[model samples]
Target: MSRIQGPEPERRLARLFRSLAPAERETLLAFAEFLAQRGATTPEPHGGLREPIPVPRPTTESVVAAIKRLSKAYEMLDRGPMLNETSALMSAHVLQGRPANEVIDDLEALFARHYRDYRAKHLSEG
Candidate 1:
């Protein structure tokens, strides 16, 4: 019988990536960043969500503004899961008087995690 050998894993991945659209390629890069961060002992507090570098708003910037800014910055993320966490953080800020910056920090982490999750799910399907 003739022997058969599958292509190398790297080769397979290259082929898969090459077939993706530009938007999909960006998703793949985001996914790669997520995976790389997963192995770190202390992941950057912001995760990979800081891309485009959020403009520095004054301390007076409303919590709502921060949420809107973050949502715009991470438009690639699936919004369903994020809505829940975001609502809770908003409540904490509005009802419990949590600091705006503190809430925004949590929001950043939440968006990053959701994007990572989104990437993982989509990558497996593709």
Candidate 2:
């Protein structure tokens, strides 16, 4: 069996926390708590929603590149809450040898779902 992948995420998260400025660090911590409270439901940072820029996926993409593309495409959606899920998928592919294509598929769906929630929340309020 493959060796267990463990504590890598925590280490990465600690590094990210250390790199952020104090206020930014607080924001990140708050976002993490929000995810803990709400599970998969992500909240947007104060902003307006707009049409996603169409970034056509390349016929070939690594999971990392696909994530970058989706983030650009759905720029309105906050990345904070999605971090947990995204990192999990990244670790799955990088550590467990999960196929890149499958990870990208789920990543696309995750971004799309966040975009939909963004639109619904903003459109309904305005």
Candidate 3:
């Protein structure tokens, strides 16, 4: 997501797209249209459509960059109790027939070790 700044929203949005690639612009347009339609068709208390509220999508280049940035932050802050909860959620997707010890090893190597590295790589940069 684009960071909030002091400028008016329209001007900020214009500035944001100035550096985006063509494909990024197209993706943002599509997402904007989808959001507009979603807002327009929302059910009202009286059983009618609500007024449309348009939302702009961030450029794909910016969006991808933002995701990468946030992913690193999430990995950094996520340790101990928080990571344990997330591990339980992800473990459900593992092969059902796997033995308990095998699952433990897989989780330790994939989630724990990788997260340790993820933090080390991003701690200074982020």
Q: Which one wins on lDDT? A: 2
lDDT of 2 by residue, 1-126 (tens): 775368997899899999988755654564455344343323445655587889999999877667767876776667777888987887687668899899999999998898888799889997
Alpha-carbon error at 75 in model 3, in Å? 37
Q: List the candidates ranked by lDDT, beginning with the highest.
A: 2, 1, 3
Q: Write the per-residue lDDT of candidate 1 for residues 1-126, one digit (tens) a residue.
A: 874467786798889999988755654554444433333423335443323335565667666666666665665555555556776877687668898789878977897787677667656755
Best by TM-score: 2
Q: How good is model 2 by TM-score?
A: 0.63
lDDT of predicted model 2: 0.74
Cα lDDT listed for each candidate: 0.64, 0.74, 0.41
Q: Backbone collision count in every prediction? A: 0, 0, 0
lDDT of 2 at 81: 70
Ranking by TM-score: 2, 1, 3
RMSD of every prediction: 16.1, 10.7, 18.5
lDDT of 2 at 41: 27
Model 1, position 42: C-alpha lDDT score: 33
Report the CA-based lDDT of candidate 3 relative to the real structure.
0.41
